[model samples]
Target: MGKLREVEILLNQTQKVRFERAMERLQSLSSTTNNSVIVADSIPFNHDEAFLKGHGTSLVDGELLTTVCGVVNHVDKLVYVRTLRARYKPEVGDIVLLRYSFVAQRQSRWRVDLNSTQDGLLKLSSMNMPDAVQKRNTSVDELNMRNILAEDDVVCAQVGESQRDGSLLARSNKYGKLHKGQLLKVDPYLVRRSNLHFHFIESLGIDLILVRNGFIWVGEHTQSNDPMVVDDEIISSKTRQSILRIGNAIRVLSTLGFTLTLAVIMETFDLSNMENVQIHDMLGSEFHVWSQRGKLKEEHVHSKKNVKALI
Candidate 1:
């Protein structure tokens, strides 16, 4: 939705009306109470019951207030707001796709950037070595740490632990150094937590990783045992094109501020292919508007089915 003024000017009268209607439908689906707030606003709450303050909330002279602009959430007696745009908050066992912004040995651990508030720590002993041995890291291995993961390397790993000092612990195996792929960044809030993040579209020969930190990686499919192994052979043109098409579809969905899920992403890709929209054309303003219209139509059909079942 960023910088869409230019795109809006390109729309004709009918398209504009359709776009507005689709957006209105989307808004209607969202919880009005959940999403209506800004920073410094007093959150409406029951005064009779004792409430525990959580993240994005502050107490000011007995009044509960929000510290960030986002949707309000409550769990039992606890209340908090989930921020729409903020740095990634790592959780234990959450898979993350990260680019090594900088890597240096500090106190015998490798500190790497993960696009979070602080760099994550990857202790030498915690990583899966090339030999796949389980032993303490020797001084020689410490000297050769660069051979494992050098600077600026894009990698995937699971969040092991979060330290009291705010640093994160990263552990890796097949989710290590990435290659033969494209990395995309999106808002962390858009990606919903799920049991499975790694997906292989066998028909397209594409691997899609939806990292919890909002880093998405699309690459050629590889065996799970050796995910980081880079094949010297060239990727097929069809596979590359499919990957690009899927990635662009994801981009368009994210731009529309839609909640990103595997189902929605696949549907978008299928819609584009069914419409014979080229990969490049999928990024155009017209295609975006069309995609929204398509989504609205799909939702309308689904709602009608529900109504039929109810009757």
Candidate 2:
């Protein structure tokens, strides 16, 4: 952590404040040190004591250290990690937004980059037809798959059952072909997994999809429809500003390494409005520091309350 501070010194005003915010976030996540797994932190096991090392652990100078941060398990003789939030360990029903590339003209499925070890598979059969019928995919569908979603298409879909080749699953067009939105990427760890990933904020006319893979989409709200028909509706000035403001909110939160949640994001947005900070100036050093430092105080107070409850 000292290295972080040293690096912060090298950054300019805005960059320094951003680092401070990220540092604050790291501290906030570390509130529960007993369970919070930090990489390279020593395990409880004794160096002399004989015990089998497991996943996320490495032996350095005869001491076991965790490589990944997650739940620790000691069963019988072997030990391992659990509930790992370090990476996008794909699960069934996870909402994901991925940019896909069609490998070849004859390929029936496009390999999607889901920010995982192995690329996700989106088959032609999983896509919704123009008429919305669930039928067996044909050669014609295979031939026209690129038309529905050509190379470099950003798709918002759900994870289905895993395939035989150990690739993450794909689903229908319930959340398909995201268009006219700003896609922001962050560490998957910062994106907390939630049962409801799609959030449409009526007040701001914004559609917020928090994909488990840390790809956030903030755009003008639109109903899910057939992917065949392109909706090229022009966004009004007011709505465009709303979209950009929400996108900036996301950027600030991500820059601070804060967990991106709907409530917190809205809170930040509301706070900015209350402070009368301009949309473009939210990224200024003053606002970033104030935002994160304020958030840190809240987390501290919340943690203290939890501790008092335990007493």
Q: Provide the overall lDDT of each model, using Cα atoms, as 2-decimal numbers.
A: 0.70, 0.68
lDDT of 1 by residue, 198-225 (tens): 7767667777888778889888877656
Give one digit per residue, the lDDT tens place, for model 2 in 1-311.
21211222367655766555555554655575444454666667755667887788888887677776565678877776653345677787677888876644437777887787667777676665667777888888777776787677778877776744424333455556777768887778778766767777777677788878878887777765664446678988988888888888888877766777777777777778888999999988788877866663223222211111100
In model 2, what lDDT does residue 24 have? 58
In candidate 2, which residue pairs get closer than 3 Å at backbone N, Cα or C atoms, i.e. clash?
none
Worst 10 residues of 2 by lDDT: 302-311
Model 1 root mean square deviation, Cα atoms: 8.1
Which ten residues in a row are the worst by lDDT in model 1? Answer: 302-311
What is the alpha-carbon lDDT of model 2 when measured against the actual structure? Answer: 0.68
Which candidate leads in TM-score?
2
Candidate 2 error regions (>4 Å): 1-40, 44-58, 65-85, 104-106, 163-173, 294-311
